[model samples]
Target: MTRSSNAPLSVVLAGGGSAGHVSPLLAIAHAIKATVPEAAIVAVGTKDGLETRLVPAAGFELAFIDRIPFPRRPSLDLLKLPMRMSRAIATAKSILRDANADVLVGVGGYVCTPMYLAAKSLGVPIVIHEANTKAGLANKVGARYTTFVGTAFAATQIRHAHLVGMPMRKAVATLDRAAERAAARERLGLDADRPTLIVTGGSLGALRINKAVAASLEALAAAGIQTLHITGKGKAVETASGELLTAPLYQQREYVDGMEDVYAAADLLLCRSGAGTVSEVAAVGLPAVFVPLPIGNGEQARNAAELVAAGAALLVDDASLDAAWIAENVIPLCKDDLRLATMGESAKHLGIRDAAESMAAMVLAASGK
Candidate 1:
């Protein structure tokens, strides 16, 4: 790897397709800057990925590469894969050369596949962060090129994986629910004295979760549990107008810009078990009922496994998360203060609050900074 004299350490972080990959890359970028104030951090992503907006908004310089996905199955697309991949790698290599990056950090995504190959071609040091228990293809391939590997889940079996935990944003990593409960409840229009259940289907809204929770709203409300449901964009959940609305025990919001308040006010969480979601909830010490998405390599279930084993979370299948399940399981769980508190403590114990700092240190060490 080439090192420039009299220049601050230059890092080119590559990943993006969804928030799952981009969020950790941004978290690490922030951590690197915090550790070395003069460090130059550049983000590399495809034009169509979420990073197009998220990276720029995070105040990082973004470099684009062509989007060329690996051919998973034989098709006409497979015949053209080689040429497309070559172009992507060339574009990524140009960016790394232009930035004179000392190291290339990759999180799992289609973009990172080419970025890792490009960095390897240039003899630059490579570091990869795998955020799922079942490692993604990009990270799996990238792991072969580097000894410095970070992982969100302890069970991830990468070649040299270190359990650095998920790099959480400051708001989530250090949040104390008890300290901010009153004001957080006031801001979210939730009852301060009552038990609150926060049901989320992520930003896109899970149809199963939305439908099931809506069907179970009455039972939850009857159990004296208030609900704040984030119905994502384009989701419309119908609730009865009289007592529920007047009492405002069931609050449905499309989105919350400040999620810290929502976390503080929540006593129980009901959501999908994506890697980021699992890590964030665990980091904040929130007891959750995780409903793994019934798609995508079963990584969501694997992501929640450790938490479930640690008594921090309960796993439910997507098909089983209906009204009856909520009434039989969630309603009683919400009312049991001792159980909820115990689970919350278990979640906190399993989380790593300084993961970003640990990842930053790994990057620095790999770069010989």
Candidate 2:
């Protein structure tokens, strides 16, 4: 049952819709291919999802399937739901068969559901990775078909789940922040000795976090702490008039392409507590103040709970995050070197740096390779 190094096993990773799902899919795929260069790696996604751009960019073949959203309430879309799902499943089954996939990996999204069902019908080994603390619908259903479920968070409520951590890209998982600090700081025009904090709301931006943090730049500057504020997309940088707006101490951007370098230079992070964010921060051992998004299944809060409990991070309510709160809590933490260092160490201890390799091993085992 073993494949030689020259003829590696094939893997089809199914998940899309958002970066959260696609990120881990690529990470695992990258891990598999890196370990076995001859492996044929393919990504299953819809034409409209983020995967269309991301999968191919990562050097994997992108296979298309029609997106099938399970309609919630009764409507025209609901009436069409069954047919849509059937088509998607048929498309997935065809993709699986054509690829001669040895294993189908689901990363828990709407796109994954169809692939999971198709994999089961085709008698292909199925492996699932759940990133959130609360299991998504796709993972919940996929779990029943196999016991080889991997989870980012230890407490993620997925049946047959084992803690394999979030599979992050090699650039992130193997980063040596301290070693890269000088060059990383220089890249951002930041002083290596100055306290640096990174405030991000996870790509789309958080209006409240932007406003609150933007308002506190003066206090942060006065405390000798510089900040890299990722104002999300299209948000105006609303710092106080005059010098503060153009100060080198406060850098603002809509997005950062080189996030690993940013993580390397940062001393503290103020951001939302999404599963991927939590895992990435923990992997880098960055001390953070997590602000869970007000909406959703309360999963964001649950995602940060273990880290907070481990003294690695602090969680703040969305409603309570204001300029005054940042001054009171965040600014002081920036000045406290010992506290940040201790928290960073604690966070690193809880992180799983080898998750990509571990998850790849799981996939190979399940495939009986």
| Global lDDT scores for all candidate models | 0.88, 0.88
Q: Against the hidden reference, what TM-scores do the models get? A: 0.95, 0.95
Candidate 1 total steric clashes: 0
lDDT of 2 at 325: 96
lDDT, residue 157, candidate 2: 83
lDDT for each residue of candidate 1 in 1-369, tens digit (9 for 90 to 100):
233455589999999988888999999999999999888888998889889999999999998887777778999999999999999889889989988998999998888889999999999999999999988888888999999999998999888989999997888888998999999999998888998999898878888998888787778888899999898887757545522222247878878877778879988999999899999888889999999999988989999999999999899999988999999999999989999999999999998888889999999999986
Give the Å shift of residue 253 in candidate 2. Answer: 0.8
Q: Give the TM-score of candidate 1.
A: 0.95
Give me the runs in candidate 1 sitting further than 4 Å from their true place.
Answer: 1-7, 238-248
Q: In candidate 2, which residue pairs get closer than 3 Å at backbone N, Cα or C atoms, i.e. clash?
A: none
Please provide, for model 2 over 11-119, each residue's C-alpha lDDT reduced to its tens digit, 9 standing for 90 to 100: 8899998889999999999889878778877798889988999988887889888887877788999999888999999988988887788999999888888999999
